[model samples]
Target: MTRTDELIALEDKYGAHNYHPLPVVLEKGDGVFVWDVEGKKYYDFLSAYSAVNQGHCHPHLVETMTKQAQKLTLTSRAFYNAELGKFDKFMSEYFAFDKVLPMNSGAEAVETALKLCRKWGHEVKGVNPAAGKIIVCDQNFHGRTTTIISFSSDPDAKDGYGPYTPGFEVIPYNDLAALKNALKDEEVIGFMVEPIQGEAGVMVPDADYIPKAAQMCKDANVLFIADEVQTGIARTGSLLAVCGNCSCENKCERQESYTRPDILILGKALSGGMYPVSAVLADDDIMLTIRPGQHGSTFGGNPVAAQVAIAALEVVSDENLAQNARKLGEMFRSEMQRIIDSSDLVTKVRGKGLLNAIVINDTPDSKTAWNICVKLAENGLLAKPTHGNIIRFAPPLVMTEEQLMDCVSIIEKTLSEF
Candidate 1:
C-alpha cells in the first residue's frame, strides 16, 4: 500500500473516529505551503484555523522552541519558571493588560474567562454567587468544552452533550435591543463573544456592534469579554478585531483608540501554532478573585510554551503581519467578489483581514462548500468548509502578495470549474 493508504488504515484501526479530516495527509510545510504524503503541494489557506499566523514552521519560533526545549520544557505550576515571568510581562505589555493567567488551549482560556467572570460576579460585582448570568451570542464558537457548548446555538455541537452547564443566556449577535432586554434582569455578570465569529464562517457583525455592546456592558456594569482566539493577534488586521482600524502605518493611532476588553481570552496563534498556549488577561481585581487552590494547570505556563509564545508574538510584531494580512485580505476579498460576480455557484464573500469566507447558495445539508474545497485541493489551494455551505479562507499572515494572488487564481480556477 502507499504511505497515504497505510496512514489512513492505521488511523482507521487505532484512532478515534471523531474528526472527518480531508483526504490529503500533509507531511511537511513552510510559509503558507504544505506538501502531501505524495509530494503534491498546496497553499495552506486555512492556516490551521488561523493558528499559524506566523506561518508553518516559522524559523524564529522553531529556534525558540528548540532552544527552550534544550534548556527546559516543563516545571509544572508547582514552581515558578524563568521564562513564564518574562512571557507574562511581555504579553501584558503587548496587550496592555495588567495581568495574565496562562492556560494550555483555547478552550482552557475560555474556561478561565468563564471562571474569572463567575468569581468577579460574586466577589467584585456583588452578584449572588450562584445566580450571576453571563450573556453570549447565538451561533457562538467559544470552544468544545461542556460549559462553552451549553451556551452554543448550534444543535450539532450540543446534540449529545448534555446535561449542559447553566447560567449562560444566548442573545442575537448584532441586536443591541436583545442584549438590553437580557441585561435588564440585573443578574447579568458578563458578555462573552468572539468579535468576529471565526468558526461561524467569519461572520462580521455591524460595524458598531462591538463598541455598542461594550458600552452597554459598561453601563450595565457587566464585564465585556472578548474571545479573540482566532481573530486576535493581528489576524483581523488590528491586533484585536475589536479594534476599529488597523492601517500598517497608523499603529500609534490604532493603539490609542483600541477598545480595551475587561477580560481578554487568547489562544491558537498565541504560540504561532507551534504549541498549545493560551492565556486570560484582566486587571488585578478581576484576576485576583481566583485564589491559590481555585485554578491551575500542569503544562499551562511551562518554560517551553513561554519561550515559544514569546517568539510567536515577536514574529507578529517584527514582521508587521497585521499590515500584510490587511493588504492581502483586501486583494483576496476583491478577487473573490469578482469571482462571485461571475459564478452562479457562489453567493457572497465576507470577513476582515485574512479571516474571510465564501458562501454557497445551496442548502446547509448539501455540502457544496466541501465539494468546492475538494476542487480547490485539486487546483493547489487548501481550505475547509465551516458549516457545509461556507468555506473559510484564512491563510498564514506570512503569505506574500504574489502567493496570495496565486491562491486567488487557484480559487478562481476551482470556482470556474464548479
Candidate 2:
C-alpha cells in the first residue's frame, strides 16, 4: 500500500479509538495551509481548534521555544524558575488581573478555576464547604477530565464517566433568566461559561447575554467565571470575547459593554501552539484563597512554557490578530450568507471573529456534515464537524483576505459538488 495507508494502519493498530479523525495525515504546516503525508496541500480551516492561532510553527514561537529549550526546559514548581516569575507578572498585567495560576492544559486550567471558585466560595462567600456548587451552562465543552465531564450534557462525552463528581448545577446557555434563578441558591459558588460556545458549533450568545449575566452575578454576589479556553486570546475579534465592543491594543481597561469575569480561564493559543500552557487569573481577594499546598502542577510554569507564552502573547498584538479576526469575520460571514441565501445545503452561518460555523440542512445524526468535510479535505481545505451537522470553520488569525477568499472559493466549489 501507499505511505498514507501505512501510517493510517499503524495508528489504527496502535492508538486508542477515542478519536475519529479524518483520513488525511498532515506532515507539515505553514501560515494557513498544511501538507498531507502524500504531499497534497490543503487549507487548515480548523486551526487545530484554535490552538495554532499564531499559525503553525510560527518563527517567533519556534525560536523562543528552541532558545529556551536549549537553556532550560522544566524545573518543577518546587524551586522557582527564572522564566516563571516574569511570565506570572506579564500574564497578570496583560490580562488585567492581580494574580495568575499557571497550569499545563486548558482542562487543567478549568479544574484550577473550579477549585479556586469553590475555595473562594467556602472562604469568602460563606457557603457551606461541602455544599459548594458551581453553575455551568449546558452544551459547554470544557475538557475531558473526570471533574470537567461530571456536569457535561453531551452523552458521548459524559456517559459512563462513573458516578460523576457532584456540586455542579447545569443551566441553559445564554439564558440570563436561568442564570438569575440559579444564582438565588445559597449554595451557589460561581457561574462559569464560555463567551462563545466554540465546540458547540461556535455558538455566540445574544448580544447582551454576557454583559447582563455578569451584572446578575455581581448583584447576587456570585462570581462570573469565563472559560476562555476556546474563545480567548484574540479568537473572537477581541482580546477576549468578554472584552466586547472594545478592541483595545492593551486588554486591561474594561469597557462598559465588556463582560469582565471574576475568574478568567485561558489556554490554547497562549503558547502559540508551541507548548502546552494554560492559566487562571483573578484578583487578589479571590486568588489569595488558594493558599500554598492547596493546588499545584509539576509542568505548569516551566521555563519553556513561560517563554513560549510570553512570545505567543506578544505576537497577538504585534501582528494585530484581533483586529484581523474582526475584519475577516465580517467578510467571512457576509460571503457565507450569500452562499446560504443561494443554496439549500447550508441553513445558516453564525459566529464572531474567525471562529464560525455553517449549519448543515440535514438531520443531526446524519453524516452529511462529515461527508462535506471529507469533500472539503479533497478540495484543498480541511475543516471538521463539531457536533453532528455543524462544521466549525476557525482558521488561523494570521490568514489574509486573499487566503480567506481562496478558501471561500474552495468551500463554494466543494458544496456545489455536494
Candidate 3:
C-alpha cells in the first residue's frame, strides 16, 4: 500500500471515529499551502478551522516557542511564570479588557467565559446562583464540550449527550426580535453568540445584529458574550469579529459599529496554530467574580503558549493581516458572485474577510459539496464541507492577492465539474 493509504488505515484502526476529515494525509504546510504525504501541494482553504491565521509554522511564533521551550514550559499555576504575567498584561491591554483568564483550548476559554458570566450573574446581578440562564444563538458552533453541546441545535453534536446541562435558551440567529424577547427574562445573565457563526456554514449576521444585541443586553443588564474562537484574530477582516466593519489594525472601540462584548472568548489563532492557547477577557467587575480556587487549568498559561500567543498577535499587527483579509475578502466575494451568476450548482456565497463559504444548490443531505471539495483537492486546493451542503473556504490570512486569485480559479474550475 502507498504511504498515504497506510497512514489512513492506521488512524482508522486506532483512532476514534469522532471526525470525518477530508481524505488527505498532510505532512507539511507553509503559508496558505500544504503538502500531503505523497508530496503533492495544495492551497489550504480551511486554515485548520482558522487556527493558522498567521500561516503554518510562522517564523516568529516558531522562534518564540523554541526559546521559551528551552527556558520554561509549565508551572501548573501553582506559581506564576514570567511569560504568563507578560501575556496576561499584553492581552488585557491589547483587547482593552481589564483582566484576562488564560486557557488551553477554544472550548476551555468558552467554558471559562460561561463560568465567569454565571458567577457574575449570581454575585453581582442578584440572580439565583444555580439557576442563572444564558442565551445562545441557534446553529452556533462554540465547541464540542458537553456543556457547549447541551444547547446546540445540531442533532449530530447534541445527540446522546444525556441529561444535558441546563440554564441555556436557544434563539434563532440574527433575529433581533427573538433576542429582545429572550433578554426580557430576568433569569438571563448573558447572551453568548458568535459574531459570525463559523461552523454553521460561515453564517454572517445582519449588519446591525451585534450592535443592537449588545445594546439590548445592556438594557437588560445581561452580559454580551462574544465567542470569537473561530472568527477572531483577523479571520473576518478585523482584530476581533466584534470590531464590525472597522478597518483599523488595532483595538477598534472607536468604530461606531464596534459591538464591544462584556466578555470576549478567544482561541484558535491565538497561538498561530503553533500550540493550544485560548483566553477569556473581561473587565474586573466580571472577571473578579471567579476567585483563585474557582477555576484553573494546569497547562493553560504555560510559558510556551504565552510567548507563542504574543508572537502570533504581533504577526497579525505587523503584517497588517486584518487589512489584507478585508481587501481580499471583498475581492473573493466578488469573484464568487461572478461564478455564482453563471453556475447553477452554487446558490450563495456569504462571509466576511478570509472566512467565507458557498452553499451548494443540492439538498443538505446531498454529497455535492463534499464531492466538489474532493475535486478541488485534486485541482490543488483543499477545502471542507460543513453542514453537508456548504463548503467553508478560510485560507490563511498571510495569503497574497496572486495566491488568492489562483485559489479562486481552482474553486471556479472545481465547481464547474459539479
Candidate 4:
C-alpha cells in the first residue's frame, strides 16, 4: 500500500469512527499551508476550525511553549503560578472584561460559561436555581460535549446522546422575533450565540442581528454570551466578531461596536493552536457568583498555557492579522461570487472576514461538496464540507494577499473541472 493509504488504514483500524476527515495525512503545517505525508504541500483552508488563526507552528507561540515547558508547565489551581496570574490580568484587559476563567478546551470554556450563567441566574438574577434557562440559536455548533449537543438541531450530533441536558431553548437563527419572544420567559438567564456560525457553513446573520440581540438581552436583564471560539482572535476581520465595525487597527476598544457580550467564551486560537487554552470572561458582578471550590480545572490555568496565550495575542496585534483577514475576506467573497454567477456548481458565497462558505446547489445530503473538496485537496488547496452541500473556507490569517489570490485561482481551476 502507498504511504498515504497506510496512514488512512491505521486511523480506520484504531481510531474511533467519530470524524470523517478528508483523505489527506498531513505531516507538517507552516504559515497558511500544510504538507501531506508525501510532502505534497497545500493551502490549509480550514485552519483547524479557526484554531490556527495565527497560522501553524507560529514561531513566537512555539518559542513561548518550548521555554515554558522547560521551566514549568502545570501547577493546577492549588497555588498561584506566575504565568497564570499574569495571563489572567492581560486577557482581562485585552478582552475588556473584569475577570477571566481559564480552561483547557473550547468545550470546557462553554461548560464553564453555562455553569457560571446558571449560578449567576440563581444568586444574582434571582431566578429559580433549577429552572434557569439559556436561550441558544438553532444551527449553533458550541462543542461536542453531551451537554452542548443536547440542544443541537443536527440529528447526527444529537442522536443516541440520551438523557440530554435541559434548560436550553433553541430558536431559529437571525429571527429577532423568536429571540424576543424567548426572552419573555422569566426563568431565562442568558442568550448564548455565535457572531458568525462557523460550523453551520459560515452563516452570517443580518447586519443588525447581534446589536439588536445584545440590546434585547440587556433590556430583559439577561446575559448575552458570545460563543466566539471560532470567530475571535482576529479571525473575523476584527479582534472579535462582536467588536463589529470598529477601528481595531490598534486592537483597542476605543470604538463602539454596536454591542458587547456580558460573557465572552473564547478558545481555539487563544494559544495560536500551539497549546490548549480557553477562557470565559465577565465582570465582577457576574463572575463573583461562583465560590472558591465550586468551579475549577486541573490544567485550566497552567503556566504553559498562560505563556502560550500571551505570545499568541501578541502575534495577533504585531502581525496585524485582523486587517489582513478583512482585506483578504472581501477579495475572496468578491472573486467567489463572480465564479458562482458564471457556474452552476456554487449557488452563492457568504461570510465576514476569512470565515466564508459557498453553498453548493444540491441537497444537504449530497456528496457534491465533499467531492469538490477532494478535488481542492488535489489542486493544492485543502478544505472540507460542513453539513453537506455547504463548504466552509477559513484559511489562516497569516496568509498574504498574493497567496490568497493564488488560492482563489486554484479554486476556480478546480471547480471548472466538474
Per-model TM-score, in order, reads 0.98, 0.99, 0.99, 0.99
lDDT of 2 by residue, 201-270 (tens): 8899999999899989999888999999989899889989898867756564555567779999999999
Model 4 sits at a Cα RMSD from the real structure of: 0.9
Could you give candidate 3's per-residue lDDT for residues 107-221 as a string of tens digits?
9999999999999999999999888999999998888899999999999999998789999999999999999899889999999999999999999988999999999999999
Q: All candidates' lDDT scores?
A: 0.90, 0.92, 0.93, 0.93
Q: Which of the two candidates, 1 or 4, achieves a greater lDDT against the reference?
A: 4
- Flag clash pairs in model 2: none
Residue 76's C-alpha lDDT in candidate 4? 78
Give the range where candidate 2 is weakest over 10 consecutive residues by summed lDDT: 248-257
**TM-score, prediction 2:** 0.99
Model 3 TM: 0.99
Residue 145 alpha-carbon offset, candidate 4, angstroms: 1.1
Relative to the unseen true structure, what is the C-alpha lDDT of residue 210 in candidate 2, on a scale of 0 to 100? 93
Candidate 1 lDDT score relative to the true structure: 0.90
